[model samples]
Structures are given as C-alpha cells and as structure tokens.
Target: MNSALVRVPGTGEVSLAPADTPEPADPIAPLAAPWVGLGLSTPDGTTLARKVEKEGTEHWQQLTPARYIYKSQELTVASVFQETKGEVLSAYFGGMKFAAVGTSTPKVYRAEISSIPKGDVRALCVDWIDTVSDTEVYHHRLYLPRAEVSETEDAQWGRSQEARWGMKFSALAPPKGKTYIAVWLTDDPAVLFGAPAVTTGALDVITEDQPRGK
Candidate 1:
C-alpha cells in the first residue's frame, strides 16, 4: 500500500495516519489534503506507483474528506458564475461545462451550492442536498443530499439530483454518494472531452493522495 503524509494548507498540520487508517470522527475535518491537480496516467490496482504531471489543481486538502469539502466549495461557487479560474469549465465525462467560484462549498457556474458538510465533526464529511432542486425553486432540484429526495423528485431539463451514492438516476450520469461526480450539463461536448473532467483529472495521478478513481 502507498503511504505518506500530506500537510493541510491553511489549517495546522496533523500527523499522517497509516494506510487506510480509520478515523471515524474526522469526516468534516481536513485530514489528508490532496496536492493541487497533479495528473498521472496509471493502470488499475497499480495506483501506488502512479506519477504526477503537475496540472492545474482547482482544490486541495489534507485528507480525502477535506478534499471533498474543498472541491465542493469551489464547485458551489463555480455554479453561480463563469469566472472562477476562467479555465473554460469543461464537461466531466461528456457532461455540462459550468463556471466555478468560491473555495468553500463551491458549485458549477450554472448550479448553486447544494451539498454541505454534515456530521458533528465540523468538516468530518460533506453531502449534497437531497433534491438538487432549490427549495425556493422546487423545479430545479435544490441541494437535498439524500437518497429519498432523488427517488421522488420530478427531474427537469438540465437539472438532476441524487441523495445517496450508488443510487443514480438513469437520465443523470452522476455516480452515487461522494464518488466520481460525472457532470450533468455543459455547453460543449468537445470541450468537456478536452480533459477527463474534474473528478477524473484528480484521479489521473496515482500518488495524488486520492485513490478512488486511480
């Protein structure tokens, strides 16, 4: 197993935990912060030996949970406007391209922040709104981060939501839970195809601290 220590940027550093160390109370806390976007092309199961190409990393975190929170914040902001990095937000795995903003609970330029850090640990973990439709604009599937909401909501054009992982809707391509967030919308397919998308981009590297998509 690949093991190493990653430091938190803004927050104070914590000792590196053993490989797959179980920290039941750190979902909302930044533990294993990921280095900015570092691209690596590695085969499956050989993630430990993956390389790093140093691409533009939109988000960073100390541990896996922290990474999610940080990325979510950035994604939340990106949804409101198209000006974050101005990187021409590409579609994630043939999905929509959204402008990003903010560094906390961010969203695509087209969408608003739906997910939020849950759990009593402050930053131990984060989840999306159950419905993805705005509570105010029920038509758009505000941020309801649970399975029950997605199962019963009336999905509309260019909008979809899932409350739990492994329970994605057929119309939407987003995976369940906190896994790969395959985008749901974008203006150009070619541009979306330019790179592998945000989640994939993060997984491209083996030593990226993130092991999910590797």
Candidate 2:
C-alpha cells in the first residue's frame, strides 16, 4: 500500500484534491472527489479483468449508470488496523464525480484536493496511461495551474477504465491500453488506496491459471 503524490506525467505538477464535506470543515474531503484514479500499470498479459470479491455481501447497488457501488470491507493503515465497510462508486463525468458527496457543495474545481497528504480520505488519480500496451506511463501533473495546462485531445479513455473497475475489474476483456488502476475506501483512507505505502508493491495474489470466477 505504498502511496505517493504522482507528478502528472507531462507537466511535472498536480492539480488534484479530495472533495470537501459539509460544515465546510469536516476535513478529509474525499467526500468532494469521492472517486479517484490511483495507479496505472502494465498488464502481465494475463486475464483481461479479475473479480476481487464477487460473492462478498458488501457488493450492492443494482441500478443502471450507478451513482455508487459497494465493495468488501476496507482496512486502515494505522499500526492498529480497523476494518470498515463503505460505498464504492464511480461517477461517469468529471465535475459529476463529486455531485453526490454532500448537501451543499463548492465549485467542482475547488472540491478537488489536488493532493492527499493527510487525513481519512482515499482516492486514486490515474491521469495518464499508454493504451497501446494497456499500461500507465503518465499522469496529469496537478501542480501546474489547470489554466496554464494544455488541453489533451486524447484524455477520454480513463472513464472507461473507471467504469470497468467499479463492476468488472476482474473480468476478462478485449486487449486494451493505458489503465489507471486504483483501490480505495473512505474509512481508513491511508492504507492501500490512500497516501503512500511503505512498500510500493501491490498484493495481487490471484494465480493466472485459475478460471476467471474461481
């Protein structure tokens, strides 16, 4: 669960942040940008997608164009760990991602934390990916003022991955490219999905030979 503020691939900057909460002071503002792109990696040329916990009761939500999706419980990163369950949703649009975070919200851009240095918010930002090989080679450097950044004509694919992660990350799909992979939960946001982890390796232990839904 090693986490670090990735410098957006091109600009060497980051302009990301967690969503703010009610009372304008709840802190841990993931409530604002509840969904984030965490890490993008090169596929081992294994299965297309794999289910992490398909049968887990934590899996809920049964509506089209889901506002929120749930997953197995989440664990904390503190020396003393606590397990907590939470809603795992992937919004279809950018500003819309924070649409359901609170009652009264701030402008979409302000809601973004730009970086998660501390607190109980968990999100992943997959700003860049090499779709040709299904690998993450670059990310959006948020440090550069968004206004000062150049517009990317090809940044319309991460959303497809986000949607895949919400319901079918483990499912096999046609060969693809540039993936911004991430695992997140609100409660103990510092563990696997939030902040940086002591070790940079991920715990992907599923054996490839096993059937898709074994």
Candidate 3:
C-alpha cells in the first residue's frame, strides 16, 4: 500500500454565508464575497459527524433480529472557534444579529442573543488542507447548502484560557431540486482514478489527451 495516501490535515478553515448563496461548483475554489470566515479554531480542529438511528425487527423464532428498519439520519459539523468576533458569535447563537455601532476607530460591535426562530438557516463550508510539500498539496471541502445551528457548548469567560465559541451545525434537507450536503476533494489518488493532481485546462483538450477512448 502506498503511504502517501495517508492524510493528516495540517490546516483548515470554516466559513458561513447567507442561505441563498450559490453552492460552489469547484471544490477547491477560493471563497468569495459575502462569505464570513470564523477564524482561529482550536487545535482539535473540526469534526464531521454522521449519526444514523434504525429500528430492528424482531421475530419470535429467531434470537437475532430478522431485519432492520430505516429511521433517521443526521449530519453535523462541530468546531470551537477561538475568535470572539461578531461573526463567530452570530454563528454560535442562532437568531443573534451582529451590528456595528459608532463610526469611529473604536467602533462597538454587538451581538445580542435573541429568540431564535425555527427556520434560521445558513450555508456552511469546511475546508481541510494536507500539505506534504510546496508542490504537493491536497484540499478537501465539505459544503452544506442548508444548515442550522443545532447545538452549542458553553462559552467560558475567564483569564485562564481564551473565550471559545463551540457550536455544531446540523445539515437540513434541501429543497425539491437541491442537495443537502456535498463532500469533494482534490489531489487524492484513491478517489481521482490514480491522478496525482487535477489539471486545469480546456475540457476538449483534456478529453483528447486521455488514453481512454471517447
């Protein structure tokens, strides 16, 4: 087995955007305007969790369950953001709005906790980069078109450690013609048909250059 396939994410990023923001077509593309970055996460980084609950059907004659019935599934991404900025605060507590007051050098930014409605949703993206060298780098991206803040850890305010906002965003079902979540990567030989890297060129040229027949 090739050991180069082993991945250890050296760095990562988490960002949030308006729910209506269009999903990125390219997995490794840089995020543009209207996307707010939640900076400086803890060393633990981010966790992507998927939970599935199912019911087993029992039969009197059989000791083990005969079959399992599908129930529900949940997908969540949790992270502790070290930044105490307005964007991080707003993301940690849903329905909280961040506003900047005063037009001076020392402007007061406020994020007030308010009644969170049921439909408060946002678009979330998580990125992981594994860099073996300057020329060899792999990028992984997870995108959720519709997601909501489902859980939050306590924010401690003390001198011992930095104030961190830890929260979990749960993916929601997309509209009739949309997707709930998407995970994509770049420069992974296991998934990219042994291609060490992705080539950015014209589609026609790429197809013609391929060894496989058209």
TM-scores for all candidates: the values are 0.14, 0.16, 0.80
Best by TM-score: 3
In candidate 2 the C-alpha lDDT for residue 41 amounts to 24
Give the distance in Å from residue 188's predicted Cα in candidate 3 to where it truly belongs: 1.8
Task: After superposing candidate 2 on the true structure, give the runs of residues whose Cα lies further than 4 Å from its correct spot.
Answer: 1-16, 20-51, 54-119, 131-214
Ranking by lDDT: 3, 2, 1
Which regions of candidate 1 deviate over 4 angstroms?
1-25, 35-83, 86-214
Residue 69, model 2, lDDT:
46
**Candidate 3 residue 60 C-alpha distance from true site, Å:** 2.9
Clashes of 1: 60
Arranged by TM-score, best first:
3, 2, 1
* lDDT per residue (tens digit) for residues 10-96 in model 3: 999999999857777765778888888898999999999999899999888988888899899899999999998778877776757
lDDT of 1 by residue, 1-214 (tens): 1111111122111111112223223223233442111111111100011122333334365333422222221122111111222111111111223556666574534643235522110011111111222431111011111111012112223435322111111112223444422122212222232222233333433443445652
Candidate 1 has its poorest 10 consecutive residues by lDDT at 41-50
